[model samples]
Target: MNSVVRETPARRELPLPDGAISYLEWGAGEPGKAPLHFAHANGFNGFTYRRILSGLSDQFHVRAWDARGHGETTLTADPARHRNWYVYRDDLIAMAEDFKQATGKKIILAGHSMGGTASVMAAAARPDLVRGIALFDPVMIPTAARIVMLMSQLLRRRGNPLADGAEKRRAVFADRQTMVDRYEGRGAFRTWPRGFLEDYVEGGTKPREDGQIELSCAPAWEAANFRAQGHNITTAARNLHVPFALVRAERGSTCRPPFPMLLKRRDPAAHVMQVPGSTHFLPMEFPDVVAKEMRGFAARLEREGR
Candidate 1:
């Protein structure tokens, strides 16, 4: 008898007007197997949720993607590329367009951390494409990053002091084993699971003329993300034209709850779920909880989802 080895979803890179977008899809039938589209976190790629797909395969056709400038995706030379945060949301809209064309199913949009912000905006912009929202602490901050966005550019105008700081951000190990030992000794995996640091080490670096690898996205890019995170999702929530839910983790400084509060304050019908034991990275930490909540939210949207 021959043994069959199950293969992971063969991800295809899509050519967008801006650049190539990397995404994964897993399903057994058409309509992308009852779609659920996930926008991943800041540091990791879409593959981080492979286990969730394995668990939810019976229930949903799960899909996720790497955000631009993260994972194995390419970066554009145009400084004007990231001028408006809506560009990121538009990318999701384009993906949803392609998704609808291909699967003919409504995509339930979910995102973790900063990706959550993009997901929310996209859901609001195209309610017809997105069925509902499942946000994991959508990087919901009180203020929009308008002032700091200008200041960071001003500092660049004077002098790009931190222009290449990401290049300087390197970790040295006595040896491979020593490095592994160090991370394992500490609770880094407990904090961040799914062999994600490898993506940072891999996607975050490029081959230099010398034997070293250089990170393409600068430290300034990360800083600018924090600055852009100032976009008030409260305003974004008011613009939502569809059913939505924001799932917040009970622990961690990174968790933001005000997003759901803003939704509820604007409309009392929105749903907000908070899991007691998880951290900022709830889907990766509590896949079962995430899967269950997603099913309930989706079902309620049809029946009881307010």
Candidate 2:
């Protein structure tokens, strides 16, 4: 017997206020299948997680959206107006509502880094529409770090190294190949698996009027995202009533010490695991592991009739 083949992800757009949200959808349009929405990290687009999402397409109706100020999303992304990550939280909530309305079913939420944090915030805000959430190394800073960041913000000081690095990132590249060459085996991308960097380069750049490819996510916007960390993720994590699973990186994790312990304390039912030898980019380094955790979490939620 010949095995059936699934279709590749379809790029689509959902109309929102002032603009549209671009997303990629995978899996057959099979009814009764739980819908899963994946959000990408800061400075990354939906297609960056294509491999992971595509793998889950067979099990769940998978969709991944490029967050505001990233990829093909047409939402307004004014750096000056970006005060905190609440904007991203609101956007994810909107997307979840849309998905719920369209499918008439509660959706599962998952994300990486910034996306993961936004997923938690959105799930907490609208648990009615979200069945559960699985996060990979969401940016839950330690208490002392948060205090220091708050102080820096109060003093109007620019002490965020991530934001500083983002501000200094090269916006324009000669071509995609140049970007691949520059990014391959370097810095944050050093641990990325094969084809992941290429996928990022393909989806993270756009053709400029000058015939050059520029970063879809502008440096200022990325820097703004990095600096806009005022959102209270602790409260969000605490507010979660549905199934929650967090896969944190062992090395250079943004979900720092005590935060994970705090999460476990707040909700002993919340699943938190640290991958051995994983970096901040856990999804890229261990896509299968992350996907397995997500699949298992969603399956448990389903079994529990969540």
Candidate 3:
């Protein structure tokens, strides 16, 4: 059993193969109704969905797990697990098994970025454990995404990519209001709340003896993970015998090849929708929209007896 007690509405923990896995579990409703299992993206943790989870907790059980390197999970002492991509997937697999054993039901796999890719991989490997899948801007097009991943990896041995300045790379604010303000000002941080960065920083860092915080998941590990992004989603997605849906942000990068459009166009079974006025971080950028779409998708699957 998971030796975890809820610290906040957004964070939870579970004992996995290696150690305790920190996660963000949401939604209330009744028990045994097929919960939505969420997964976070890179440079962010599960609590990034704080506001989003609060609104959806009433209708469905929304659960998000911190990947091997983020949130309360760590890899500083024994870097072996975070060093490999398969370790993250293996941790997720354990989470699925734990949830299934506890609830006696499969879940609706929902993921973002790398988490989205991991969701696909998990569903592909354990179809019986997944009734449906919903992915948000998962790093697709194994080639390009892999390049990005490799670039991140290359930066690991060299130095922190964002070392030049924290103000440049990704986030715009250290505080919530500051983030919201800069979102419109800088144009990159829009739609995301302050909690996203807070949770990300909290989950991604560990205390150092010299009072410095070191990244829990090494940049190299993250790079290696990204480099392996091009593992062929088409083949994996095609073999998906379950219902699947995709929610893409209007301004985000593509996770798959452009041909997926025509391919999905021909395969009418796969449903895809665009979340307008949103960025790559659908859950963070637009939680209400994400919840509304996810609820509808899950409701349809439930009706179909999935």
Candidate 4:
């Protein structure tokens, strides 16, 4: 059984070039203290990771936000405009800048999977705004895999295959509990705790006027994110100069050893931990472990006076 205590985070929004991004805050966020800004994985929202984010609030002020198409944030009406994940990277950069300006200290950027990849990209592009980064099984495809994935995109002319799955996904349910009941112990959510799954269902969906709940992030957008995985993560990893900690799942990690090895070579100070018997959804399955490492990364940054 999971023993982590969860808390409700304050919801807020930040206006961006295209639309406003919704974020959740944990802790007081005292001024002059460096804040931890988090991004959620693809198809998931900031609220989905509340258990993990809330666990670290005692030591640090943390905030997590929904990407363009996830959670309460505005969706991208035109997927054509965001062919790559650079748009997500830019949004992260903007959020970091805004946090720096608001807190008068560089923010610690962190994320999982697609969110983690975007954090690495933002940190590399604008190192001044970020003091450090912690990635949780970031969507980092190896060079050979990347080439194959990109080449496979050419074979799908009937729109993105992943997107098709999203489009066919069930969006509404009888209620939140019903959704939770159906999702628990089923498919990808099998490893997720009941409380965490409930939180995800509560935050990821909204009640419609028709007396049903619907996903805030439309299927097409989630599919677009999967299809737009051609970003150059290798270059970003090479360019990252900030202190970074990467925790990968042992069994089904999106980030393999070579990528973490490359990151260690590029930044010797970087920390890497592979949790045995875990999957890519380590953040959800092991919130306490992930939060401990995040705090440790912060401690390391403070030790280095970064």
Candidate 5:
């Protein structure tokens, strides 16, 4: 897949209440074909998944968007305020609605990390807009940890460790190439292919007047995402009525499958599988596997005709 050159996607933007949401579309599907809509991980934008989405575009029309405060999407008013993960869910719901109204068909939701979590909430809230969901290691805290997470919010802690760490991130770089060089095989980006890393640096950064580049998504906003995790997945999972497929990473994943066992129990058709030798960054490490899982999900939905 890495050897093949992919086509550049057309950029588009949508109007929101406070600002506009930006996205990329890979293919054009006919009237009856269900388009696939993808939400990206926290701190990362839709362009980061260009390789994976573009690969699947041959069979499925693909659209991936940047979350609020990420990529080219304008920063929300008062970026510091994020009570919970529901804001992202709401944003996704709006995007899904807009997409459906424009295309005249429901869409399949596919996402990783925060994107996956928000997808679940969107599907639950507006089942009419979503045909099915394919989640890749969405962040789902266990019952015990969820209680503590909510308690910390109630307690009003002094500083958010994640937010603080994000504030300390180096956002300015000499150039996009410099950023790519630094992340090519290091830390969280160790498993990413060189082309994917290049795509991330090129699409996720904007040139500054000083002849340097800075991250489009503010570090503070990324930190805020880490700090906010109060979405009630238990309810969302139970409420989801459409075909659902989840792929979790085997090692150090934030999403634990059993947390939403009720979905499996309620609908025996729902599928959940943990990918061995994968971590929180499974999509980046194994794009083909992620694509395969999503394809299988679409096939299941087609066979079930739900």
Candidate 6:
């Protein structure tokens, strides 16, 4: 039986320009406990990982934020002006800095997919604020592919399949159950464990003035995130000076070949592992595994006095 106390995280918001960055926090502030900030994947909210974060609450101060254009974050998300994922990196850096100033302690940065990639970038840029990093199948495209995508962006070409799909995704639903009924066991959500899907629906949607619930992340902005993949994550990974751990999915992983290999080569101390029979949604499918890895990583960092 799982003995970890699963506390319902408290919802909070960090003020930012034009809007606030909404977040969910767990664990009481205990002396000597290192803070861990978890970022969510694109189109997902912080509440989506409540089980994992809540489980870690006993060991570390756990907090997860809804990125701009996702969840209840009121940040300006003009897809037309968005260029790359750097905005996410910058936002995360700001949050880390704010947390550090408030608590007077360095933080552990962790995330899934886009959130993971952004955490890497932020850690590389400001390692002083981050004690360590934990990533789950972050989207690290090959250098060649990044170059090709850069060229496409430079040419102003649009219409990525992922982006197109996001744009066409159903945005409005009568209620949470209706949304859950539509996404319970289909497509990318097929591997999601029970209650995770319901949490996603709860956090990923908002009540509109029309008495209907709609996706908190606008379809256009989600599509924009899919298209804006020009950031240099390889360089960011290579520049890590702090301890880090990476969990890769066995199937449909965005952290493709050569990236993880090269990351290990650059930082032999970096902990990288691939879970068998796991998909990109590994955290959702195997929350216990993800939580265990995170707790172990954070424990190591604490033992090292980081």
After TM-score superposition, what is the CA distance of residue 161 in candidate 3 from its true location, in Å?
A: 8.1
Q: For model 6, how does the per-residue alpha-carbon lDDT over 88-179 read when each residue is reduced to its tens digit? A: 99999989998898679898999999999999899999999998889999999988987887687679785577888999999999999988
RMSD for each of the candidates: 5.5, 2.8, 6.2, 2.0, 2.0, 1.9
lDDT of each: 0.64, 0.86, 0.64, 0.83, 0.83, 0.88
Give the per-residue lDDT of model 5 (tens digit) for 44-122.
8898898888878777778899888889887383456776888888889988988888788788999999999999899
Pick out the ten consecutive residues of candidate 2 with the lowest summed lDDT. Answer: 1-10
Q: Residue 191 of model 4: what lDDT?
A: 90
Give one digit per residue, the lDDT tens place, for model 3 in 1-306: 111223346466787545788776654436755677888876566766655655666666767776875667743323333333455556777888877776778878888887887787778778888878887887666546445655765677443333223323343234443433444424434454555545555555566666555655555445445444436566566565667778887885556566347336534676688777767866767666676777788888878777
TM-score of the candidate numbered 4?
0.93
lDDT of 1 by residue, 258-282 (tens): 5566676754666677888877867
Higher-scoring candidate on lDDT, 5 or 6: 6
Two-way TM-score contest, 1 vs 2, winner: 2
Which stretches of candidate 4 lie above 4 Å from their native place? 1-7, 29-32, 75-77, 157-164
Sliding window of 10 residues with minimal summed lDDT for model 6: 1-10
Flag regions of model 1 displaced more than 4 Å: 1-7, 75-84, 144-168, 171-190, 194-220, 229-232, 253-258, 265-269, 304-306
How close to the true structure is residue 298 of candidate 4, measured as C-alpha lDDT?
A: 89
2 against 5, candidate with superior lDDT: 2
Output the TM-score of candidate 2.
0.94
